[model samples]
Target chain A: MKAVERVDQFYLLKQLPKATALLCKEGNLLDASCSWLEIFGLPPINKKQKTQIFSLLPEVEDLIEKLQEAKSFNLRHEISLNNETRHLKSYFAPWFDEKENVIGTIVQTDDITSEVEKEEELNWLKNIMETKMEVSKTGWWEYEIDTEKLTWCKETKRIHQVPDCYEPTVIEAIEFYKSGYSQNKVSMLFHKAITDYQSYDTKVMIVTFNGEERWVRITGKPFIKEGKVAKIFGTIKDIHNQVIAEHRVKEHQQLLTTLVDSLPLNVYVKDLESRKVLVNKGECSYLHKKPEELIGKTDFDLYDREIAQISREEDIQVMKHLTPIIGKETVSCLNGKTTHFLTSKIPYFDLEGKVCGVIGMGLDITSMKKKQEELCDLIKITSMQNQKLISFAHIVSHNLRSHSANFSMLLGFLNSEKDQEERKRIIKMLTQASDNLLETLGNLNQVLDINTQESETKKTLNLKKSITGVLHNLSAFLENNDTQIINNVADDMVVKCVPTYLDSIILNLVSNAVKYKSPGRPPIITINAIKSDKGVLLSISDNGLGMDLDRYGDKIFGMYKTFHNREDAKGFGLYLIKNQIEAMGGSITVQSEVDKGTTFNVYFNEES
Target chain B: MCILMKKVSCIFIVDDDPITVFGIKKMLKSVADCKDIQIFQNGKEAYDALIERQNLGKPIPEVIFLDINMPIMDGWDFLDEMIELNITEHVVINMITSSIDPLDYKKWADFKDRCPYILNFKNKPIFKIEPNDLGCITAAS
Candidate 1:
């Protein structure tokens, strides 16, 4: 060894392996260990030259004050080496001479670059985890079974509104769960976790340290060591806002359900397929079904087929147009009894305002409809009575006045005549006129009695039975007249009418047929029934004698008007029958031709 | 039958009512004509007789007292037949009616507009007519 190297520490530092250096106050390198020289890209010690330390580490100049500190200090700074960024931490202690005067810094650096980078990455991950816990309103808590200690994270402390320095015990932590169900439940679960190593997840309400109530999700897991629970750690999430919103939604749903269920009318919600999705009490009762039985059923299942078809079509129309059908009167029948409903339906919209179904309400109006029908029948009967009175007045003036006029004319001739024989002849003509008046009065009386018979309840009579009975009575007369009778009335054909009036009507028509049998041919009278909207139409057609209907059509049903000149043609028969039919709310019409045939089409009240 | 002295050579008393027809026949013979008074029960028989007379070249009644209300055919129907057959060149129809019905008056008015052989539209009972009234009656056109 050189004699100077034995006393010089710088020369002795030359052989050190770690990066150690001696630097002056101006941040210039004085002596550096070989490892330091090698790491900083310097030459070996034997051929070393003074190198500028600040050139490679210009940022190190800011740490020069750290190098001069009396005790010891460390500094970290960045350097670029071989196009790679690296961090270095250097420790500096004051260098002293024998006289105790500071000269420069003895700097020892370690490539702590990897250590600083690892520490920086760890700090970044820790920051991210804390921020995530804060954002999610989640916090952790741990319980040590043996120590009976509970420790809370910063987020958990914040959730409980506890002071930062507060320490918690297991009993105090469980007390945070609001008393009763929440507190009791958590206590049981905590006991179970400690004893049986069970895991638990539950939602509970808690009272914070600040005396505010809150909802939270509590979860726990037990860690076992050697068949014994070491600790139980879990998350407690602040779920206050979410739980409150859910509570509001549940309340609203309950309110709507209660309101719809209480309505007396038939309220229903139908889906796009017109199936009953919801029905109120009234609808269930009207259909005679329970809610469970009625839900998911269609109108066709509850109503008659024809009525169901109409209801479904209306539902479709409402949904398609997105328009409401308000207060339309509809009819329903059950067990042969009819009911009326004032129904309204509106399109049921989804959240998007699209018509997804129909909501309908039906109000019972059967009694109101019945009253309206009664009013209509009253009006009809009043009009019919008025018609009867008018006809009565006209017949009295026309027929009776003519009779009185003849009496006056004959009485005047009897007084003016000079011969007794002519006077006697006038007296006999006067007697005949009086007899005609009496007969006219009797006919009018019978016509007036039609009102009484009409007031009686009508009965359903089979047309075939009535026709057969009449034909049996007329069999002898028909045989004498050589009349061919064709009774074509169906056996099931029925009409509602007064019995005696029907008998008289049949007798009058049949007698007229036989009385007016054709001189050239035997009479052919056909009686048939056909269904009509008004009722069963009985057609009594004859081939005996047909008058010129075109000329005398207006007077065919007139009092004392005859279409045939037969001696027995009373002319009052058709008029009487017409009055009877009109009083009973039926009608009669005739079609005839000269010398062809006459057909009397009579309509009776429909059987109820 | 025809008579030279009777004002109407053959007068027809067509009525459904016997009393009315008897009174008219007696009055026509006593006040209007002396003989050849023809009687019919209704307008249908009256119309048939007129058609028969026209077909057989017999003398048609000079004056037909036709009643408005009759069976099978009425006075209006008889007049319709008369107008259709064109046989009223020399005959006159006196429409007799007891109808106070306005419809009858309207119908008579309608026939008056259509026919030239309407002599008169009279009320019931020709017993009130005098011989001078019958002489004054004549066809309007």
Candidate 2:
């Protein structure tokens, strides 16, 4: 039996290569495989005396009893040798005789250290990948075009609110996209990627399995194999929070743009370099350009040199002073219309409290300015009319008072006189007083006539003919005074005036020249009319007893203002002539000296 | 009546109106026992006559009635010229006016400051002389 067992052991050892070992019933080391010796760093066994296995490996001594009792036993053990630990699996089986009684044991050992280390490293890698995917809400996807199979990572499944083990078909995956543009767009992109090997990177809206809306960003890449499109892979990121925040920011910006455009006033922003950075609708229209054209341009590019210089200087001042400047700016448009603006320029500052540019706003005030000027002109005319009315009141008071006084004096004389000759003289004096009273009334009536007459009575008349007619009417008085009248006026010179006023004006001026003649020298009157841009300038000059103008310049055209001591100085002729000339839209001015001469220049409007 | 008893040596009436001059002369003749009376048509004529009298070594009038508002030089101008004449005689002047203009009174007050010889500023139509008017003139002279 022992010989047959030895032969069986030797055959089993030879067949099992380096992993098998044999032991006797006494627990002694018999034969070891080549692999076992190599793993434990042991020397080859010799055939001198049988070796106990305990002495070879002391750690396996406890297992020897179990190995002796059981039919077959297996054990995993760690042994330390040469400062290194090694793991080994040992199996012991009893060798059987023909009578079924155990003779010896067969032992086998395997070096399993590398296999355990590999399994631990694989577990650590799997744990790290799952944690990364959970924190970032990022996942990967793959689509096999041939099989129409789709695969999604754990994070991707979470994003879609699906079970972890769920496998989606290509069509089912695309259905997760919201039904409108997102679904169509994703489907089209999937097909295009597979057929054309195209890559896509875009944001898309998706509806999850639970019917919750979410925003996601997908980046796709196509793979081609054997000259045919095979697979599509990409990353689908859950970017709901980022996309919503960005959308809200865009909405706020659009609202601000609309508010600025709605303002009627011109609003603009300019950079430090005087380049326009932003402009509203009003500003764009004011510049006669679109907003796109105006932005990035300057005042120098949009306006004339003079206007641009004014705007640039104001902007620079506001920025430099870091304060607002408000003022009026007049701009003349290309159509020759002028507009006035009340413009304000304020300095704009950056986050660091530095003046970066200027912000400008302008309000149009052209109509208001025009109305103010018209009001001023109206006030002037009303005041002038009030002065004339006051003067008229004074004339009525003085002239009427003087005439009544004369009548009373004459009546007193007639009542007291007793002598026949004195009585006759007093009667004559009364008659003369009545005549003078009647004459004064006639003169007052004529003044009233001129005052009430409308300007519609004015007509163009020959200036020379008017003067000649007056000279003819006063020829007798002129000859008696030895007055020489020179009418140097052109025969065809016309003046816009009322015919009656023209006749009266000429008569009064000529009569005055003759009446106020100097006692020392005969009067020489010169009448001349010269054509000017405004109208005809008719000047009547006289070498007579001219009064001092300094003392009577303001009073020369006042009623009852007499400068000279003359018998018939009624002080009404020049006053009436001034009123007539002014009524015809003309003006009269007088220059005089104490005894040298006097010149009266009358200016008439060309159209009137 | 008092003027009828007191005799004025020489009286001058200066006025532009011939009727007024004649009436004043007649009233004076009836009131006083005086023959030396002179009349001037205006202030300019009166001034010339006074100057001529001074040059001829004649007696200047003691009482002169001057009318304001005349054709030539008025009463104010006559008074301005009278200051330059350097008249040494004591003469009483009666200024007269036809109208009741307050401006004429204001002018008289200014002239009276320079020429204190003016004794009275009387209104026109002196139909009858009051005894007080003659008494004041005689007292001032």
**Best by the lDDT measure:** 1
Calculate DockQ per candidate and list them: 0.48, 0.20
Error of 1 at A79 (Å): 0.5
**RMSD, candidate 1, Å:** 8.7
With a 3 Å backbone cut-off (N, CA, C), the pairs that clash in candidate 1 are none
Query: TM-score of chain B, per candidate?
Result: 0.82, 0.86
Total clashing residue pairs per candidate? 0, 0
Classify candidate 1 by CAPRI docking class.
acceptable
Of the native A-B interface contacts, what share survives in model 2?
A: 0.21
lDDT by residue (A1-608, candidate 2, tens digit) is 67566656666564566577777788776777766667667666555666776665676657667767858978788777888887777778997779988878887888788876787788888888778777888888988888877889988999999999899887789999999999999988887887788899989999999999999999889988999888888889899999899989989988988888897778899999889999999888876789889889998887778878888998898898887987656564533667778888899999998999998888877788889888887787677777677667656665565556556665776677678887887778778767867876887777777767664566878888888887888889999999988889877899888888888888888888888778899999999888988888988899988877664677788765566656677677888888888777788999887677888888887675
- Interface RMSD score of each model: 1.5, 4.0
